[model samples]
Target chain A: MAIIEVNGISKSFGSTQAVRNVSFDVSRGRIFGLLGPNGAGKTTAIRIINHIIIPDSGSVTINGIEAGPLTQRMIGYMPEERGLYKKMKVGEQLIYLARLKGMDYEDAKKATKYWLDRFEAAGWYNKTVGELSKGMSQKVQFIATIAHDPDIYIFDEPFSGLDPINSEMLKEIVLELKDRDKTILFSTHRMEQVEQMCDDICLFNNGRAVLKGDLREIKRSFGKNTINLEFQGNAGFLDELENVRINNRSTNFAEIRVLNGESMQGILKTAMEHTEIYKFERIEPSLTEIFISTVGEDNINPKELG
Target chain B: MNLRQILLVAKREYLTKVRTKAFILATVLIPLGMIAFIGVGVAFAVWESDSEHRIGIVDETGRIFPRLQSVNEQRYVDVSAASPDSLRQMVVGEHIDGYVTLGEKNISSNANPEFVYGGSGGLGLQTSIRSDLREAIREERLQRAGVSEEVKNIYDSQIGLDTRKLTAEGEETEDDTGFLTIIGVVMGVIIFISLFGYGGLLTRSVIEEKTNRIIEVIASSVKPVELLLGKMAGVGALGITQLAIWILAFMGLSAAAAPVAGLLMQDQLADASRLSDQTDEAVSNFDPAVLEIPSIDPLLIVYFVIFFILGYLIYSSLFAAIGAAVDSETDTQQFMAPIMVPIMIAYFIMLRAMESPDGSIAVIGSLIPFFSPIVMITRIAISEVPFWQIGTSLVLMTATFAGTIWLSAKIYSVGILSYGKSAGFRELLKWIRER
Candidate 1:
């Protein structure tokens, strides 16, 4: 059963429609990725799900209940902007936040201690948050968010400020939480991370979801018919072949697009006559290529994509 | 939202503030400095007391010299013998403050003593010397006029008048109590103003936290109202603690300084007593009760505490609301000006009440909740205020406080999370309308 269902959710900031008819669902114990470039309404949708904001013309359900205070208790949200009291001690801050999520003092203390130790940040528990590095503070924030052990977790760019080693550790922790039957929704521009961790992906552009499905299915649907033939000698063999276009030709390789009627055997026989082929294979499209194609390259300005 | 959570937040705030070096210095050093200041003031007063003029006399006429010496040997001046040139040089060097050169003549036409002063003699010293000389000359003239000493004394006696006042309830008290009442009113005003002013500081501190985004994390585990109440309670506790410490320190310093003050006062009283002995007919006759210190009413102190807390809470909630509504401290100045205007007006009204406790302005201002906390205390100090007025003012103030809390809470809930823009009056109106 779907743990969270967002149907036709729409929200606008002033006259600009930030999220228009955005819809998606997360099943129990699965990792859902909301992928988009900057200002793509991913944060807006996440905010609506967290109930920090209300959708203008749609409904959201969590564990069969409509969004409200009780539903809020079941979700752990880490917002894009960092929110932590810089002057407060790390352990005290974490426990206080945990207690806010409905833990008693004793339970909050134990959980805070455990999480701090697990993150190898036990020594920093007594230090003020301002004294810690950005990555260290981020780790403390992560602990505070998850200390309540909510049923669902929403992380907005949780890995943005993390170092490679810490980011890997956080990814492992997120996967472990998913394994424990906790549904998670994470929004990011890192396509490679999504490919590795997300079971289902939703791609958004201009406040609308343009592509979404199982990761494997979406990749499969893009197909694998294009081929690259690297040849030592290929001056003018492409003119003799029927229904084949040499997309590009270099000194030792030619990228060919074969028409539907053209056979692979015919292409191979033609290539054999022309030159000794160093490499010949069909290529699957990368996520970067698929995102660029589906979302359209016009809006995908390189500077804003990151 | 629970009481415990509110207390936890309050405790954190209070502890953080108390542990800071600023709080420690303010709490400890201010009272000590006040004592040192008072000590310096008293020392100056004492030094001024001794430096007043002392006149030396060198009289060739025995009759005039004896009389002049008797008059000059009082508290303000000392009389002794010296030649005219020696006296002049002593006056110039300030060895003698001033001197008199007596002419050799008794009831003669051309024989008046010459007086001289050292440097720029002040008005007080000049006045003293002139009065003494005039009195001596007048007596000599009276003796020459064939009036006997008894008749002269009788003609020169001063008559004293006593006063009594009747209250609205037909009760009579001495008019001297009016001055005592004024002192009491002044004390009450001091307490009332200090509490309200410092309590506003507490509220502003809370608002600073919200504006700085520190309150978001705090409120995540606590309710907004709890946070508000806890801060008020915590800061109130700190204020009370600081006040108690100040009062205790003041009392201790006063007790330690009282002996020296008493010694100086005793010396002044003794000099007055000696002068009174010499001029028994000159001193005015009045009842000792007119000069007695008035006793403090415990009930008045109790009323001060009650009004202080109520007034502080009322103003503080407004301050806190203003703090939350604005995004930054600089934006708060515009709102603060309007809020403080009423408080300033109220304080001045209270001052006016000190002069005329039963004036129309005082009566109306005391009845208004905004000014009642201050003006009522002044009225209670000077004259007997009707119990019903106090009751009515309390009820009105309580109602106003309740209303303020509800309204501020509405603004607080919306404003606490808002950022980026300066929340203007129009936006506030919109927030209220939306709520």
Candidate 2:
């Protein structure tokens, strides 16, 4: 069942349309990724889902109920613009935020401690957030966001400031939450993270969703029967294939892009005829390549709808 | 929001603030500082009173020297004889506080005698010496007239006049000192309640949310109004706690200081004792009526508590809203000035009420919700304010408080999450309209 469903959610800030007809859904237990470069309205859409902002049009439903304060409690949101009371102790801040989510004092404390321990941040319980390193503070904030054990979680750039080790730890935690059947939607510019972590993806560009689907499906659909070939004696491909483009060539390797209707076997035969092919394999598109092609190199510029 | 949730928010605000080292310091230091300041002030008053002034006695005819000696022994003045040049030299040398250089003419001549000192002469010393000289000259002239010493004493002695007033109920009363003392206490209480009670809450609440940034989190969770009121109530409870502590502390300090203050007041009371004794034998024999001043009125206490809470809620809500609206402590300066203006204006009107409780300005200001908290207390202290007026003012103040909370909450709802942008009147107005 879809835990969160957004339809045609549009918002504008003054003359700028921050989000236009933005729509997405998060089914139970899914890790949904909202992917975009900066200023692509992902943050605006997340805000609209979290009810931090009112959309200029459209509606959202949480757990089949219209959005309101009760639904707000069901969702845990970590905003992109990092906000934490710098002078407050990590434990105190977490418990306070937990209580706001309707946890009793003891339950809030228990949950706070549990999350703090899980994040290896129990040592930072008494330390003011201001004194913590950026990575440590991010860990504390991550704990705060999920401490209430909400059914739905929205994290915007949750891994932005973390070191590699901490980022891995966060990914594991996010996966753990997903395993527990918590619907999660997170926005990030890092497509590689989405490729590794997200089950479903929605890519936004210039205030609109440019590409979106199950991560595997989106990557699969972008594949053009391409073959990456590594060979020793290839001077040129002799322009022999009916429909093939040499996307890139190196000293001993060539990436051949075949037309949609062509087969990879044809490309492999062509490569074999042209040079001593050392390695030839059909390739699926990487999320990075697909994201670049769909969103365009300059994601900030508005795209003409085709 | 429910009361429990509001209190949850408030509790967070209060605990975060009160546990802060700065809040603890302010709470403890302010009262101690006030007591120390008053102690220093009293000590200075006593030291100034005790220091004897040196007066140069010219005594051109040598007739006033005996009187000067007798009066100087009373410890008010130290007298010395000097040549005119020596007197000027002594004044310049700072050997004396000041000197009264009597000329050959009667000391009470048209030209007021000049008192000289190293810098500016002390006015108290000059007045004391001049009065003593005049008394001495009068006695000498009276003796020269050949009146018997006993008769002259009778003629020189002052006849005291007793004063009495009847209230509207026809009860007799002593001089208006009792009323004036009540006025003083009222003014003190007004200042105490406004500054420490209400304004202190404002400062502490600002510091708390600033520390916790629960403000930011809550700004996202609930409307700014809920967060702000919750903060105000939470810190207001802390303020009330601190107020209770202070009231007890003050009672303790005053109880401790009273005997000492009494001892210091003994001289003035003794002088009064002497004058009272010289009246009719029955009057003199009677025990000094223990001043029979009315105690603080229970109704006034009730009014004080009610108005304090309401007034505090009004201003504190505004303060919290302002705190959320601004980004930093320095930015608060621009906003705080406007908030403080009403408080200050209320205080000045309270002062005016003290001088003339029934005056047009005092009455009008007291009827206004903003000024009523302080001014109504002043009125209740001195004269009997009509119950209907108190009721009307309270109703008006409560209504105003509710309206202010609603408006501030509108601003707070929008303003708390808003950062980097300096929220202006237009933005606040926009928020209100959005609401």
Give the winner by TM-score: 2
Q: Which 10-residue span in candidate 2 chain B carries the lowest summed lDDT? A: B286-295
- Per-chain TM-score of chain B, candidate 1? 0.64
TM-score of chain B of each: 0.64, 0.74
Tens-digit lDDT track of model 1 for A180-235? 99999999977756677889889988899888878778888877645688878765
Off by over 4 Å in 1: A5-23, A37-48, A51-61, A65-69, A189-195, A202-303, B1-4, B33-226, B247-299, B326-328, B381-383
Instruction: Report chain A TM-scores, every model.
Output: 0.83, 0.83
Give the per-residue lDDT digits (tens) of candidate 1, residues B1-435.
467767776776677667768778888876677569879999998987676556776555555555655676553333445566777788788777777765545345545566687655688777776777767666766777889879898867999988887967888966655665565465555556554556556656755675445554444445567767777777766766776776677667656665666566566666786867854333334233333344456787677667777777777777777877876767777777876787788878878888888899998998898778778877886777889999999999999999888877777766776766668888777766652
For candidate 1, the docking band is: incorrect
